[model samples]
Target: MSALAGVALEHPVMNAAGTCKSVEEVDSFARSAVAAIVVGSITRQPRTGNTGNVYWPGRVYSINALGLPNRGLAYYGEHLPGMVERAHEAGKPLIVSVAGFDVGEYQEIAEVVADAGVDLVELNLACPNVWDGGAQKRIACFDPGQTAAICTAVGDALLARAGGDQAGRVPYGVKISPFSDPAALAELAAVLAELAGRPGGPRFVTAVNTFPNALVVDADHRPVVDVELAGMSGPALKPVGLGQVRQLRRLLPDTVDIVGVGGVGEGRDVAEYLRAGAAAVQAATAFWNRGEDPSVFGSILASWIDAGGIDPVDSAIR
Candidate 1:
């Protein structure tokens, strides 16, 4: 067992947001061995997501722009209460990933998730696939100022829903894109530290959204997917994810937990994340490669336990 953001988890492994988007997918996670149910990087409106050859998977790496396809708020909202109950019955907390077009939408969607009684919320600030005209939409985590604004808004909303005490309220975190530049990473961490000092601050940080704008081409010299570029994941991304987690662990106080993500394909990967000081870890490409089957988690988790994945100072399992 493990704990993330003060919520008890049966294990440290849970599916990443885009890995499971539908009510059925989320419910499958609830019934599976996963420690939590992560639903949506959902938007205020229904999204068909990016279509037409949007995904391509490689042996140890995959790249494609998914465009954050989701059923929108109304569909998930109506089904959320039931999803939460199912998760609770199975001894797991429901964590919703909120993605919005603007700061106000983040607050609004988060309020609905908190009201539905989710145990945790993660604001997705690093989606690199949403295209507007020819360029991608602004990624929230890149700018410290905007990141602070979004976090402040969402925090205030969640705190208010809890009647001003975060103790009984839904805790929150941010899923940030991977950083290749030390100075940039430090800048964001400083902003996050400042936020962490506040009452409505982040309870945890999920590191390393896929490396953005990666384009894969086949032997035929054509783009692997329909889009020119997409986020990259699989084994190639693990190192970057680990580096981000390690740095965040050192930079952020222990009061703010860290959840590691990237290129995690097996039990050893889980152990690696723990060694890097991740309270928990999430998976996407690994799960996708396993045919969206929950058993993949069981296998990977079994491997982790065999590898002595738990660490007193690093792993969240005490």
Candidate 2:
């Protein structure tokens, strides 16, 4: 079993938050082999976000400005308990993803979810769409100080709100922006390494959240969504994801765990990520297009694991 941020997972494959639904969305997933299931991003207040068809097209990619639409805290709180129970019954780790505009919003949402008994919390510190109200502009999140501030705030909040062994038991981590510059990525990793030395700090990071913007317009040539840019995620993003894993591995301390999520479509993709530095890997878009095939990419990974081709404990930076 692989453990990240104190959550012990039976496998290394996890569904990215917002991409995968609760056990309620795909009934078959309840009994599937996915190590963890990250629920939708929950916010302190409900947000309708930008409406209409927000998904944009690409030759081998797609851009979206969904505005991080969510069911808000109250409803999520009411429904999440049942979701968590169902996931637990099916023997899967439950991770709650939290997002917000600023420190207060992020902290409040995380505290509420932690109280709901999630095994871990994924903080979205670098959501392109949410960063500037659909400006869709691409900005780097490679600044270690900026990255550390956002993560530390959420981490401290989680630790404070969930005091006791229970508090320490639920570890916190952040997701990074996909288009991070090499220097920025190194700086961010350095910051995370520094924070790891603090009394209570984040346990891991899900590097390279999504690929840089690849805006696609509708047939009318008008923007699909109001946002001019959108985050890219799919098979095309795998290489960038691997680069992030390697970069972070080199800069971060050994204690810091990494969960790679970007564009993993096959077992080899997972293997590449693991060899790079990820303790675990998450594939969103590929599985999203595969429909009900829970084993779409997982079967490949299983064979690799069986063959010992993928090592979850390998932390090599390059």
Candidate 3:
């Protein structure tokens, strides 16, 4: 079995957060090949999300500016117990994506989800569409200091579970933006490295959210999607994602897992991330393009198996 952050996955293939938000989607994951079920990047209040055509999947890649649309943390926290049970019943873990607006929000989310018994928390530090009063905000992953503070706050919340200590704190992971500079990655890694072995520290790092500020136009010479620019993903992003994974695998402590995302549409893509040092991988564009069908995961897994399969990453050459 493949594992991430000490949680066993039926395999390394799972859906990216935005792709698995609804209750029906949760059920679909339980019936599919995904290693785990990830619920939100939910906020304190429900968000209507960006309107208009905020998404476009092309021949090689897809672009989206869907915003951080969700039913909010309360909805997620209220239903988390059932979700966790469903995932566990299916022999997988349930990881919630925490999209807090601030460090305090992260703590609040941790308290709620942790109390509800989620297996893992994914701290979303790099969503390009996070807006404040309709104005887009900066992504936190780019600021090392902010990243540390948020992580510490979440850790503190988890600490409450362990009686003022690190032990028993729920392990969390950071979903960060793709970096164009090695310096940026190294900076973030340094922060995460400090928390690598400590309880309540991040135990996994999701290599990318999406390449930000990417624009695509249709034949009319106009922006294809309603948004001026959006986060890009799909086959074209594999190189960037793989490079990030390779760099992260080198930068992070081996004990921390690396989840590779971007441009994964098939099993070969999944294998590519594994070869690039990702312990597991997430597929978003492919799943979306296939209409969010859970079977897409099964097909991806089957394709991976057909490609002669990969030996466990712990034994394979990376």
Candidate 4:
């Protein structure tokens, strides 16, 4: 068994946000051997998402500019209780992934989801496809101040709901951008480290959201994605994501958990993330491309860990 942020997980694998968009998809994951399921990132209102060839799959990696299309928060609020119950029955935690255009929106969504009795909430700060007022907005994770503000707001919101106590409070984490720049990464890590030092602050941080703004072209040399750029995932991202997890693991105190994401396709990939100091790992493209039951991958990972084929360092922060 593995544990994240004080919660025990039957395994260390879970689905990434946006991979499971519908209630049916969430149910499919619950029935699988995945240790947990993170629902698609939900916005304040429903979005139809960007138009034109939004997804392109290749041999090495895949490109997507989905623009966070999802049903609004109200839809999830009404449906999540049942999903949470089903996940509990399957011995898994149902983590709600939330996104917003601004700080208040993030806090509001966090408060609502926390009250819904979901096991965890992930604040999505690194969706590169997000467009506001017909323009691409800056990724939240790139701004350490804004990122910390949002985390503080969400944490305070959850704590307020618990009558200013930490017990029985809902835990929350942030989904960070893939930092290709070491300086930017250290700045963000500093912000997270400070939050981790506070009472009722973020309990965990998920590293390496899909690398943003990849340009893929057609045979005619024209851009393939309608947005001209999209987030890239799959094998190409493993090195960058793994590096980010290693960096964050070294920066944050052991009290904070790290969830590694990006480019994970097999048991060894999961083991690699664990060795990098991730308490758990998440993925989407591998499951999407294979078009098979997610449990198949989870079972492979479980067997690898059980047979002692791979050894993960103790999850405690070193």
Best by lDDT: 1
Model 1 weakest lDDT span, ten residues long: 309-318
Candidate 1 per-residue lDDT over residues 59-80, each given as its tens digit: 8788868898888899878988
Candidate 1 yields a Cα-based lDDT of 0.86
Clashing pairs in 4: none
The predictions' CA RMSDs to the true structure, in order, are 2.6, 4.1, 2.5, 3.0
| Model 2 stretches astray by more than 4 angstroms | 21-23, 26-28, 56-59, 131-146, 164-167, 217-228, 292-318
Give the lowest summed-lDDT range of ten residues in model 2. 131-140
Number of the candidate with higher TM-score, 3 or 4: 3
What is the alpha-carbon lDDT of model 4 when measured against the actual structure?
0.85
TM-score winner between 1 and 4, please give it: 1
Stretches of candidate 1 exceeding 4 Å from the true structure: 133-135, 310-318
Error of 2 at 183 (Å): 1.5
Q: What is the Cα-based lDDT of residue 134 in candidate 2?
A: 38
Worst 10 residues of 4 by lDDT: 309-318
lDDT of 3 by residue, 101-139 (tens): 889988898789888888888999999876687678899
Model 3 per-residue lDDT at 71 = 88
Residue 66, candidate 3: alpha-carbon lDDT: 85
Please give the ranking of all candidate structures by lDDT, highest first, separated by commas: 1, 4, 3, 2
Instruction: Give lDDT tens digits, candidate 2, residues 1-318.
Output: 667876777668877776654446524566666788787677777767666766654556656666677778887777777777888888887888888766677777887787788788888776667645535433325556566667677677766765634335467887888644677566677777888877557788887776655676678888776766677887677788888888888888887899998777667777778889999988667665665466764675565565565455662221
Model 2, global lDDT:
0.71
